[model samples]
Target: MKKLLNYFFQGLLVVIPISVTIVVIYKIIFWIDGLLPFQLPVKLPGIGEVNIPGLGILTIVVGITIFGYFAKFFVANPFFLLLERLLERTPLLKIIYTSVKDLIEAFVGEKKRFNQPVLVTVNKESQVQRIGFITKNDLTEIGISNQKLAVYLPFSYGFNGQLVIVPSENVEKINASGTEMMKFVISGGVTEVD
Candidate 1:
């Protein structure tokens, strides 16, 4: 009886979050669809209104595909270069364009180093420590050399609350998978493998 109760509660934990996420996403899409003046014709002959779900996501995909197709051929062409020069001459548009372009490139670029994971020490004593990933490496004349690693320590509940840099020797690289490590952290040390 106790085992069955535990299984029921575990199923509830999984189902509730997934259902809530889908409902929230659907509501947001409905709200955005309300903002647009466009409407799809009713599916049935006499139906009043019919709306498609996830149209916003489809629109984003189509836009990105078109932009990528254009960018691939025009990025290095002389005509496109001239247009880019003209756009850069504008003060306000130049700033906004550069900012957005850089942000998108950082998100989609191959050289983005922040997503690369690395192990780091959290506290002074090695016994009580947590897993973290490297965010940046500092190489400065006044302070630490180029060898220092900055790590972002994520909290158990969600997201990050602490950031620190530890020397290379203090960190012990583990052979566990990232998903396994995340499970350990999310369980607040209740789950671990020998």
Candidate 2:
């Protein structure tokens, strides 16, 4: 009974992730297809009049590609800059826009702040250590850049993390990819890498 139950659960663990992924993708595609404003009766210019169920998803793809291309090529730089300026002028919009922009840039932009994984000595005297990523090397903005650095320590078994400002002397940069570090931390140290 124990062996059979173990095998059953092992199979379930393998199948559940794949099943959930497929279901979620299917639902998202369905939702996007359902966003069609109206059925095309006659032929249109770019796309001919066809009641294609997946056309909404296709349109979304095309729109996002065009926007990304424009943004990448700086074709929409002036417009975006103007919009940012306008938002910065407003107190509420400034906070919201800047926070969103900074978070996105930190994760996805050229300067990926979380890529620099390191081993931090939390308490130098007792040698309490922790693994984290260097978030900020330059603390000049906060007026403490002499020997201080900001590190983000991700929690085990959770998505949340804590950011701590520690002295640069206490941090030892590690030679590990961000994804590897994240996976190890998320798995609660179950996963190992040589």
Separately for all candidates shown, the number of backbone clashes (residues 3 or more apart, or on different chains) is 0, 0
The digit string of per-residue lDDT tens for model 2 on 161-190 reads 999999999999889898788788887888
**Superposition error at 76 for model 2 (Å):** 6.6
Clashing pairs in 2: none
TM-score of each: 0.61, 0.73
After superposition, the stretches of candidate 1 with alpha carbons farther than 4 Å from their true spots are 1-7, 31-44, 77-107, 126-128, 141-143, 156-163, 174-194
Model 1 per-residue lDDT at 8:
100
Give the per-residue Cα lDDT of candidate 1 at 131: 77
The candidate that achieves the highest TM-score relative to the unseen native structure: 2
True-vs-predicted CA distance for residue 56, candidate 2, Å: 5.3
